[model samples]
Target: MYLYDHYDQAMVDARVAEFRDQTRRRIEGTLSEEKFRPLRLQNGLYLQLHAYMLRVAVPYGTLSGAQMKMLGDIADKYDRGYGHFTTRQNIQYNWIKLEDTPDILADLASVEMHAIQTSGNCIRNISADQYAGATADELIDPRPYAELLRQWSSFHPEFLALPRKFKICVIASDTDRAAMRLHDIGIQIVKNEAGEIGAAFYVGGGMGRTPFIAPLVKAFVPLDELITYSEACLRVYNRYGRRDNKYKARIKILVHELGVDEYRRQVEEEFAHLQTLAIEPPLAELERIKTFFADPAYEAGLSDDLDLSNPAFAAWVKNNTAAHKTPGYAIVNISLKPVKTLADGSKQAGIPGDATGEQIRVMADLAKTYSFDELRVTHTQNIVLPHVRKADLFTVWEKLVAAELAEANLDKITDIIACPGLDYCTLANARSIPVAQKIAERMADKAEEIGELKLKISGCINACGHHHAGHIGILGVDRKGLENYQLLLGGCEGADTSLGKIVGPGFDEDGIVGAVEKATQVYLANKEGEERFLDTYRRIGMNPFKEAIYG
Candidate 1:
């Protein structure tokens, strides 16, 4: 995690003071709702369906235990006693009072956090893999680059009023856990044959009314020119991206209208122009940011006495754990899947309820006690304690079970990813959570037969849940006020990623789980015993799954 420099600290302090005054005016009626909308949105405050929602940035999805505690405190004192972890790897409080927002920002500032650039048509939070620095396969830590972009884009005068909201993702690993290809700007960190590290840039990728897998703009952008080149890309979009219609305002629309080749040519021309006035950050400054992300002090010795035989611990290890960069530690995913009965009983059908305050507190404590006091909210709607020592795995699993947070399904079939659909989001066309929950429960019932799979659901084409990247994707839609879902399959999130294709006609929300189950059964029947769902799907292609799903 990068600490704020004096410049960063000063800017945040000043912004807090400015927002405090803005708050006072809004409450005093000196500023009308119409007038205050943009001001409040710039600070990450939104007037939602029922109340104001305050989204706080968890930069690159990294948080210290103390920071997590502060978030828990904010949830306890300011709003309801729980926060919603979002797909963008941020946290949201849905019941904030308008007057309390500035105070909340001040509180967040105390912990080196804030709500800046979280909303409105500006560069939003820069997301990276939750397992960034700790992942065993990373080419390099991507956080320093993410942090640099954060500083450069935050309140960048030219970009604050872009044609539409823009998102950027940077991934250092060959495996695309961050869904880099789906971002407005996806940068893959890679080393050239000459052994110099640079970025492979992908542009115009997004998932809204229109979905696209961004095409590559540069095979290798020099490390020193990342900022300049990014600025050039945004500047081109800001200048030419559609603004006449909200539906076509995104850069993706621009890319679609102009065609990818033309879009690339435009960006290249812009890049060439930016080179004349390039304002590269000093190499020393880049190195300084990198220092903050240097590997944590890790013990070198291995403990052979560790036991992994307990059934519950074994299940958790087998399902929710991943290899760490260090030999003696593991990345642990805390499942958000409710018990089958509770999941079925929830009002919205498939979505689980927010983590209770007690659950949040337990997780915070566990992070402090067992995982170096660090926690990451994953894109899969689960929390990750990324650096748990191998020795503490069983103890952590036991504590998680007591809190009902341990379902022992990390990348398994029941570990579904879904967004807060109709339950909370006004933009949702149908309820997504319920659909995801039902599918998870269905898979759980056939846990032995289903084996490993990924099912992702999103309420609409916005693809907040990343439905496009799932091996099994479910997208919710509205048909004459009736909830319906479309099923897609064969998408992947790893090295050789591709978007899923729709299986056939859509299903009513109630029929979605059965449809998914049918598809899974086809995979099970057709697969070689040891093959994963994705491997099986690729080997057999989508026809088998589609025929089975729609049969």
Candidate 2:
């Protein structure tokens, strides 16, 4: 993790003081709600359904054990003794008090974390693969660039009031774990034909009332010009993106209206001018940032083997661990899904990306003991100890089992991605969590048989759960004073990213779960040998599933 320099420290300290005053003014009625709204939003505070919610940033999903422990501490001290880890790789305290926010921000600053850019119509938290540095498939560690972008974009005067809330995601590997294509600006670090490292920029990717997989605006941007090119893209969007309608304000809407080619031309024109303005960060600063993300030392003679004698341990390893770049190490993913049981004496669903305070501390200690004191937050709302030695895999699993964090359902049907729908979100028209729980319970038994299904649920059309990118997408819609969920099929957020198409009519709570199970059953029955759920959907098309659900 990049430790804050003097400048970083000074800025954070200064901001905390500024916000403390702003908060005091709001509470004292010196500042109106209309005026204080943006001020509070920029600082990552939102007045939700029952109380204020505070979202704290986790840059590129990277956090040290100390930072993780601080989050646990914050949850314990200020909120409701738990935090919601979000798809954007941040943490949200749903039960925040207005007066306690400043103190919370201060505590976060002390740990080099903040709520800055976690919300508002500005560049939001920069997300990337949780396994960025440790993944075997990565070409280079991307956190340095993510950190550089983080520093540059934070409070940048140019983008402080963009057309809408903009998001940027980065990925170094070919696998699109961060949903790079579905961001306002998605940058993939790539090696060109000449073997020079550069970025492939994807613009206009987003999901809301309108969903778009960002097209490749520019094939390649040189390493030195990453900042300049990014500024160019932002400058174009900031200037041309529609402000008349909030729904169409995202860059994706702009790209859609203007077409990708015209958008590319505009970005290029801006890039040409921005380059001359010396928008690139100093090379020394980048190099200095890189040093902070270098791989930790691995011990010799560490064996790349796990004792699978325990069937339970074997199940967890099969689902939660990934191959590591290092010879004797493994990447371990922790499931934060709180278990639910059905009324019929069967298992139910789970919360997609939530961890209790105790679980946070346990994970922090696990990272310290097994993963070089570093941990990562996955986009799917799980935790990753990206460099656990394979020899200690069972030990880690045992600890996780004790904490109830080892669920053995990474990409399975039970591993759902759900937004805090009507339960916590004021924008939501329907309930998402209960629906997610129901669906998970319905599909829990056939997890492996179904295989690699990315099920996502969103409370409303904001697509916070990334329902647009799920293999089985569930969108909660308000129907005549009742909650109804509409199902979708064939969505993917990967190297081959595509948005899902809605399937027929919306279903009531129980009906929706049954619909999802029927959709999966359709896949399981028709799928060829070893075909994943998405694979089957892609192969056979939506007709089969649609027929099953609607008929």
The lDDT per prediction is 0.83, 0.90
lDDT of 2 by residue, 1-551 (tens): 79999999989888899999999999999999999999899999999999999999999999999999999998898988889999999999999999999999999999898999799999999999888989889899888888989998998999999999999998999987899999999999989999998889999999887999999998888889989999989999899999999998999999999999998999889888888898788878889999999889988777776679999899899999998888899999998764555477788455678788888999999999999999999889999999999989999999998888889889888888899999999999888889888777767778878889999999899999899999989999889988888998889999889899998899899999999989988987898988888988899998988888887
Give per-residue CA lDDT, model 1, range 1-551, as digits (tens): 68887889888888899989988998899999888887788788988767899999988888888788888888988887888778788888889998788889999998889999899899999988889888889999998999999999888999888888999998899888877888899999899999999999989888766778888888999989999899988998999999999889998888878988888888889888888885879768789999998887777885624587787688778878888988889889887765445554632222442576667778889888877778888767778998888988888988998988888767766777787788777788888777776676656756645677877888988888788888898899888988889998887766677788888889996678788888878887888869988889889988877777666
Candidate 1 least-lDDT 10 residues = 344-353
Which model scores highest in TM-score? Answer: 2
Candidate 1 total steric clashes? 4
What TM-score does each of the candidates earn?
0.94, 0.98
Model 1, 351: alpha-carbon shift in Å?
4.2
Q: For candidate 2, what is the lDDT?
A: 0.90
